[model samples]
Target: MKFSRLLAVLALAAGLSGTGASGAGAAERVRVGILKFGTVAWEMDVVRANKLDAANGVAVETVDLASPDAARIAFQAGEVDTIVSDVLWAARLRAEGKPVVYVPFSAAEGSVMVASGAPIRSVGDLKAKKIGVAGGPLDKGWLLLQAYAKKTAGLDLAREAEPVYGAPPLLQQKLESGELDAALIYWNFAARLEAKGFRELVSVEGAARGLGAEGQVALIGYVFRQDFADAHPDLVKGFVAASRAAKALLAGQDAEWTRIRPIMRADDDATFAALKRRFVEGVPSRPIAEEARDAAGLYAQIAAIGGERLVGPAKTLPDGTYWQGK
Candidate 1:
């Protein structure tokens, strides 16, 4: 009788151990690196606030960094599984054999904004005017604008306009203060200016279209190390799904804005509304897919305009740059 009791106890212990092991195996954790003010912050915040990751059967840990560069460093050091960044950066990394893959996060791009009362009615009107260009002269948006001007307006903005390089806020200030007649600014800033009656000379999408690229050329995306993605495909899918769900909520409901409004810290109702509109406009309309041909065409255009400095010498999109799922 004593021997039988000991056997039963050992069997029960083995079953519990197996159950615990299975549970541990089922709950995989994924770590994502994000910047405090980066584009992905709002969506990631939604995911965490609602425990979306847990609902999706994965444990997500968000590591907030000070800036984009800090996020990049953390990702490179294997401290985080994924980071929010531009697709072009992912292409550059893949070109350097970094084994990184890009997943579409946002499709919104900046635009060229002119003062409401300014005489700049078209891209051609930018001639001989002070144009505030963000991210310097070689910025992708500036380069695309340059290409658009040369292609559509039959003039070179580089030679015609006095390109004033500054941050987006400074550019906006200069435009408002009558120092800059026009400014190429991000969508959010452009939206704010539009709300205040500024005229949008050209959108990045419009510029790209004029340059012959088709469809929405996604500028921003989430990049992950290929090894990590391969090791935990479900976790990656879960993250993307959670992010997409958050985006849907933002797109469909005005109530969702209240949750993220604190993070935005808008000074007034008008600014908040404008920012919200811009944010909703930026959400991808379709599921994220690998648009290799479109990406390749846009890359060619960028390479032609920016040369070795912006997109490197390859002038072509790298293989495995887009995550096609498991």
Candidate 2:
């Protein structure tokens, strides 16, 4: 199994696909691009462990890549059938005349992490302090923070905080090393930091709620091109069912966690527990229509601050962005 996964990674990196897109059979393979250490792989592990794919009449393959960029590249090159991305990207793609569709994955978002004893208590306290931000200047979480601050605190975090942008790991390290006053990082990294005694000053989810977004917004999801879905509609729908089943297993059973702990790379029991709890907390439970409504609202809030370059070409979410389980 290990050898095969390694080969899959190599094939993904080389833009080679072992699966065919011919869609002549229900068992025709469906390859999903995954980041090697991403949380998405955890759910995929659950799916395989439970044989959910076989139950749903789909043959699933996972292509591991070193980074999100690599995963997107592999997917775009037709080396993988789907990638776990966000509705924002799908909206952007639709605006560009490519009709990508989204399947609800997780509402899990990032947070602002400060030292446990750091003086910063709210967005207002971030003024003139150095902040380590992941996902660059146009990151949705960072932009949401800015919008939330402007609406509630009458301050723009992007302008007030000395913005230091880097990858999630780099930001995590800097926050731990005291080189940063606060770090806005993805949820998994935030979970690790929280386990290490870092404090969450503000969560992106809380900020979105403060901005009047309804329901739990599934910010990220399994995204694929519509043309690809047309090729294997059953496979696509089956993958969704398999994903839902996997989420149910992960959310309800501790037994599954015991099996997948090693893949999580958690250094301590606290980290392991944190990752498990946060991941389950992110499971999408709201109806797709409700989540889509919230996502559209959240998009406008971020776009008002992030503009076209960050929010993408769509001024609003394009129609048919959500798969709606059809």
Candidate 3:
């Protein structure tokens, strides 16, 4: 682990420095590892299309990976500078003695879904019904839903309902085929299901609000080693600014999303439009301090449910996990 981190630090320094002779003429490059279909790809396309990263003094490069787990492996081996992940996983790494820095990526927490015509009207209605939960028992969305059900209705999903863990697409299919009474899934899948006429039982974000979060919470983020940030503070900040700029463009313009629709895999116009709306609605608008504070509280809530299997030793977010850049 130490050796790999050293290699990553050195590689990042080289990527940031550019050619010594070119000086300011060359842009600081950031090689980000991402799943080919991950949402980060859409932002990278915008950043590259509009030269947002270059405008911010950085060049954005993407390394395509097969899966999120593959991206993590590549990131740890120093094959790439960063990957998109949540503060929970980052905190787990820190607690286990690895240091990293997190930059907010998106605030799109997913939703709980039921068939549009189903009789299940609320979370309480899901009692004794089968629920398909994507990302497993430790998935942040599932944990939040569990917390919400317990707090709002005193319904313990673990005992009152059956949860079958599976991938997002599979869960969506099962719900459509009547195999699942309700499914708590990732945002993009929820958007797709919405296009197919599914009704939301409750949004993870909405549940979070009921549980006392002041505003939207951003779970996923762009994470890189701390040493890399220390070595290239300006570059790291540039990446963050460029990301925000890409999001701004996508949020405001319908054309930007239209251009990326092919990659979105939206089978129809309704799905395409729904995805665009959900993505725009998820843009983080809260202050950094508030995001950090809410994240700490949410972590405690999930830790109480998932225990050591989910969070390792640290129940709350460890210090220095969330980045407050200059």
Candidate 4:
């Protein structure tokens, strides 16, 4: 009888231990840093609202930051396991031996906007005009514009246009008030301008191709420490799955836009609808591996534009920079 009792006790302990482990696994959380007005905000918000992380067997907590620099600071301080940033920044970080890897997130969606009735009708007409540039003078959009102009029109925009650097919101305001002739604004800001009767002169994707990158290059992605991804491969896969699911949801359902419209803070219904359309248009349809070659080419284009400051001295896309196999 004692032997039988010992066997039963062993079985019960095993069951209890298994239950404990499952519970712990379910509770494991990953913190991600994001900027308030970045491209990642929409998808991250969708993931949180729909409980996609929980469904995928992981928990994610998003930290809202004020600026891109703040997000970098939070990541460096170990307050966040991942951040939503561009591939160029990820390449720079990995080049510096930071053990960073990028998971493809959003397609390039910025464009140069001009007043509907403005005299500037072509890229060549932008010469000698006041151009408002977002994310500062060395921003990717500005650099791409410079390259596009020099390559296509044989004009140097940097020497021709009076480049005024400022935040996206401020640039948009200046453009509306006629303080600038044209502005190379971000995706959302460009969408808002379109709603207000502004027109796109050229999209970032077109500009990139004009500067020698392959078709539809992905510019932004989710970045994380290599150690964190290695330790929790399941979490990384789950996160990617959840993100893709969110992208799919946004793609098929107009109702999903309603859920995220509040976060966009659009000034009007037209602006909101335009922003939603622009955002959905930029969602990636395939994994990063499928676009590895194009991504490498895009990286080279960005390096050429910004030189050492943007991509460091490497001037090349570092190996293992693109996350493969989920």
Candidate 2 local lDDT, 1-326, one digit each (tens): 00001101111233543322222244656788887667888877777767666555556667777788888887778778789987777788878887888988888899999999999998889989999999998888888888888889898776676999999999999999999999999999999999999999999999999998876787889998889777667667777777777788888889999899989999799999888888888988887788888888888877777788865677887888988654
* Arranged by TM-score, best first: 3, 2, 4, 1
Off by over 4 Å in 1: 1-26, 287-290
Report lDDT per candidate: 0.74, 0.80, 0.82, 0.75
Give the Cα-based TM-score of candidate 1 against the true structure.
Answer: 0.87
Q: Which 10 consecutive positions of candidate 2 have the poorest summed lDDT? A: 1-10
Clashing pairs in 3: none
lDDT of 1 at 218: 72
Model 2 residue 147 CA deviation in Å: 0.5
Q: How far is candidate 3 from the true structure (C-alpha RMSD, Å)?
A: 5.7
Q: What is the C-alpha lDDT profile of model 4 across 256-322, one tens digit per residue?
A: 8887877788879989888878877787765466567777776777688788988886697898988
Tell me the deviation in Å of residue 267 in model 2: 1.6
In Å, residue 194's CA in model 1 sits off its true spot by: 2.3
Which residue ranges in model 3 land beyond 4 Å of their true spot? 1-25
TM-scores for all predictions: 0.87, 0.91, 0.92, 0.89
lDDT at 156, model 1: 90
